[model samples]
Target: MNTNSTIRARRIADDIDALAGITEPDRPYTRRAFTPKFLEGRKWLEQAMRDAGAVTQIDAAGNLIGTIRGAHPDLGTIMLGSHSDTVPDGGRFDGIAGVIAALEVVRALRDQGTVLDHTLEVADFLAEEVSIFGVSCIGSRGMSGSRPPEWLQRVAGELTLEQAIADVGGHPLHSAERDDIKAFLELHIEQGPVLQNEKIDIGVVTAIAGITRIEIIVEGRADHAGTTPMGARKDALTTAAWIALGVEELAKALASGEAHFAATVGEFEMTPNAANVVPARVRMLIDARAERREDMERFVDELDNGVGAIAAKTGVAVSAPRMVSDNLPTPGDADLLDVLDGACQTAGASHRRMASGAGHDTAWMARITKAAMIFVPCVDGRSHAPDELATAEDIALGAAVLLDAVMALDTKLQEDI
Candidate 1:
């Protein structure tokens, strides 16, 4: 399996270079969705698709799609892609690599003079990164029919999201759901050190972890910091500190056995401005993520029970954990995962199964189709920053794996779909 030869590392490098140049000159890789820079990047992707012999169009959701007709157009489509837009200073390869790699697969197929049975589509999903519209996965959510209609009215500057969609060649009011996608595949950089540290070539994503944010408030009587005895006065700040420590201990225990669990006291606030005054109140927000529903449930239960004891011991009133936000985990399709595992083997790539700690467009796409994603290694698992890195050689290998998966899906789905 000569992956470098098949995927054409030079084309991949050139595509990255071209798109990397369309960023804000000062920011050096910033291309927020609905911005001019983002649109320019999209235009480049559209033309690249055309050069690969794909018929291109923008969906109502503003997803840029490039389709190459297959031997049997009546059959369902095999979709491969990732987003192209970036966060301010977000590195060059967050979602861009996947899009370019998908394009390369199509070009590689043409080079081999092979035609698939199912039509292939390469997508550059709009705003996979949070955009000026203040929401992420805008294109994917809209495409899957999960995007709230109210979100269409979300405002950014003088334009509503609906207007912005139009500016980018989308028909927001005429939003449509995709029913013909036989399977969807997204190739992304791991954006973490596991792949690189372990010397793995690919990560077969098992699931996209769900995130839940909980707010906990700690209240205590205000007293003079200098006069109040350590045992006599209840300090909200001290109580909050204890709770934060408890959160860490519990999270560490949960993380130990390993189904991708993490909890952080990400937000904290204290009342009273004076340095001499004891904190009258403290508020904390916990950002917890779990790959399995049961793991989250257990973590919440343990935390809730621990909170009562903590407040009792501290003599400070601690409110129950209030869930400010909660979203369930999205598991990859088993059949699709099997296909990816087979793809890795066929491509001569070393890989492992893992769960994504971050959210992705694939999670939304899963709502409507048998969708899954793969991760290639990035330097230090860094992303959403200027220093994030993934080599062209590594990306090409990932593309080869994706190409293999596409071929498998094309043949495998013919009987099922």
Candidate 2:
């Protein structure tokens, strides 16, 4: 790495270490949204942005935006950022790395005494992780005017979503209608093993997978284990287990040749906890995703049919309701992808084009403006866990690519204007 890159890498490592220290004391790194630890972490980040000499503010949706003025403020701004919230007992890097990288880009620009024609804005969005309210991307969705109205009514812990927004100095009803934002770019960890396994330095995301979540319930009669004979008992847990296995089998069968398809029963629960009684009900949460719309549809169809068959064979009443259906795959803007590719080349970082299996704030930002993402490899492709990690060198390389890409976009947008 070059001397500048080495310096930036050290800075990035230091910032991550500092932020990691602001987590829940008992949980180590748990900084869920709207929690005390999460709030403390945001405060630290806001101070860091102000110390970097940028104009900072929290938006109506609780997104913390720090703007650095450019030579020609009339031109639209180039925005970059990610979220700071983490999942329960989550790792240190996932969304936090992106926010720090965006700030690093602004700091680097200041250090070099560089100013572009378009203003630069770095943001740390609120609640990008799945909240207790069963919603994700609340801040980004609010910014793009895509948030569901019911989200405001849902209560998480002691506060409703709306109240949480207000507590953070945000107006939940307000949306940012700024046409001055020309584009958005985010730098994040790959969260998968592909980049590390391939030994690639950078990953230019082409598209984000469409996610579908279904809630499956199997109802059966609760009967005394001794009284109910093995042939007479209707076991809901056994039936739900069959359906879960069926989901895996169907996904594997459909993904035989496709690389971007996945289905998992990540959440499962059973009622009537008694050793002498049969389970009365079983609830399973099914999460499925794919790169293509047709594949997703087919997978859902197969799962539905498989569940029906299992219900018939097990003699249990089964119902699979579509709880969350976000099936539109957001493709990265072509022009922005080209810019990112060029940035990778200029930074001398080995890169490959890949599709993101996980969703990001960029997907919602793409609705408002051109949006793209840069991914750096994490150790063993692990994320959302305590062991999640990325090398300082790799993180710095991704941020360098982001810096180059932002500069390229600034020039390109100016010429277009």
TM-score of 1: 0.94
TM-score of each: 0.94, 0.94
Model 2 clash pairs are 192-381
lDDT of the structure predicted as candidate 1: 0.92
lDDT tens digits, residues 123-169, model 2? 89889999878789988988888888888989877779999998887
Candidate 1, residues 338-377, lDDT tens digits: the string is 9999999999999999999889999999999999999999
Could you tell me which residue pairs clash in candidate 1? 191-381, 192-381
> Model 1 — which ten-residue stretch has the worst lDDT?
1-10
Q: Model 1, residue 161: what's the lDDT? A: 92
Model 2 whole-model lDDT (C-alpha atoms)? 0.87
